[model samples]
Target: MLDLHRLRLLRELSHRGTLAAVAEALSYSPSAISQQLAQLEHETGVPLLEKAGRRVRLTEQAEILVRHTETVLGQLERAEADLAASLREVTGLLRVAAFQTAALTLVPNAVTALARSHPGLRLRIRQIDPEQAIPTLTARDYDVVLGEEYPGQPQPRVPGVSLHRLGRDPLRLAVPDSFDAADLADLASAPWAMEPSGTSPRRWAQTVCRTAGFEPDIRFESTDMVFHASLVATGHAASLLPDLVWAATPIPGRLLTLPGSPARTLFMAVREGAHDHPAITAFHTALRTSLTTLKTTLPLPTTEADPAS
Candidate 1:
């Protein structure tokens, strides 16, 4: 019989992409990880990893095992859930993965609300990018993931994972506090701090700039929304920001709607088979309610209002 624990570690190495990262995340020493993986390969009687220039790469056999490991881990999670359900109590750790902005401004309030309602539940939150969050959630590292999808961009589809739309955050053009640009076209020559390429927000910002008849001169690149706002405030660079970033503290800038008034939809994702798990269901409810309340409190730009008006 294959050892499920070792299989899980192997699966995590594949998802996390580094032995050091896996060790740090799982709280194991790097040498310990190496020993366990070496033992796993010895027991299976196949070479699972190959040394690249600096990092170890998984062999084809290891990739195959990783795929099956996902199934095995998922089944194990389901079995545990079933046992917990049989006991008729929701008492287990719920791990959540979320991006920076949502983690900073939204999730804390939601967690507080959840704790008030369900005192028995234990929660663990991790700050992770949306791109990584989906895959990790599918691998069962996270019970639920808070993810975002920008307007006109294709949302990533993770097989066997289910998504629930929580709320929409309007995207706006953020300019320097004293600068006056009649429209997006007028700011074509302005320096921009954009989300890194391959992210949904970055793609949307580029498309919006193109549609307005100019390509942006992107001077800085980062996925951190707080840093993006700070650049705009300090006159270093302008950017596109969502309403959620302004929820707890207002960014000192002129917020204007894009030509189409685009909005990014935030959602909660879970493994399709584990949707009925009590902890997942409860947290989802709390998140939705918190977002609903936030919509009323956050400062959102009026689509029809002109910045000059």
Candidate 2:
């Protein structure tokens, strides 16, 4: 019989595409990962991997093994879910990952709600970018991930992962009090701070600027939204800021609605079969409740009505 653990390792290698990546994600050395795959090949009596330049590619037999491994993994997830449902209470740890803004704003409230409702269940969360989080989630590093998508730029669907929409977060133009800006076009010549290129937010921001008839002068770039807000607050730059940034405080500067009053979509993601896990479902409930509670406290910024909504 093939070893299930080693089979899982093989499956991980296929998804991750490199032994080094698989090792880093799962916290193993590259040599250890290779050694395990060697053992797997010994048991299967076939070549599971072949050299392709400096990297490796899975053989047909390895692909067959990975397909079967996926089925086994899904079934195991169902069995675990069923077992948890049969228990008197939800217990054990749930690992979660979220981007910076969500981590700062919504997750704390969700944590409080979870603690009050399900004291037996424990949560472990880390701040991670959605770009890096999704692949790690597939590797079983995190049970759930909170992510966002900018307007008109829907993220591509990943296989073996299930997504649940949380809510839309309103985005507004944040300008320094010292700068006079009424709309996106007014800031065409103003220095701006935005997320780095290739990020969804950066692309959406650029599209918004282009649609307004001028390319923005992005003088600063960073992934941290709070820093972007700071730059705006201190009169260094302007930014397209999300509502979540002001969840716990007043808006730092003048906020104007973009041409269409665009909002980003937020969602939770989990493995396909683990979506029904009791702990995951409970956390999802807490997140929804927190969002509803937070929206009531969010400051209303003066903005044009959203015709598209």
**Model number with the top TM-score:** 2
Tens digit of per-residue lDDT, candidate 1, span 36-77:
999999999999989987789999999999999878767866
Cα lDDT tens digits, model 2, 1-309, are 999999989999998899998899889999999999999999989999999999999999999999999999989998898898888899989999999988998999999999998999999999999878987787888999999999988988887788998887888899988998777778889999999999999999998888889998999999998889888888999999888889844677888877666898889999988888899999998998887677667767645452322
Show where candidate 2 strays beyond 4 Å.
302-309
lDDT of 2: 0.88
In candidate 1, which residue pairs clash? none
Model 1, TM vs. native: 0.75
How does model 2 score by TM-score?
Answer: 0.93
For model 1, the superposed segments whose C-alpha errors exceed 4 Å read 1-73, 86-89, 138-140, 304-309
Error of 1 at 219 (Å): 2.7
Models 1 onward score TM values of 0.75, 0.93
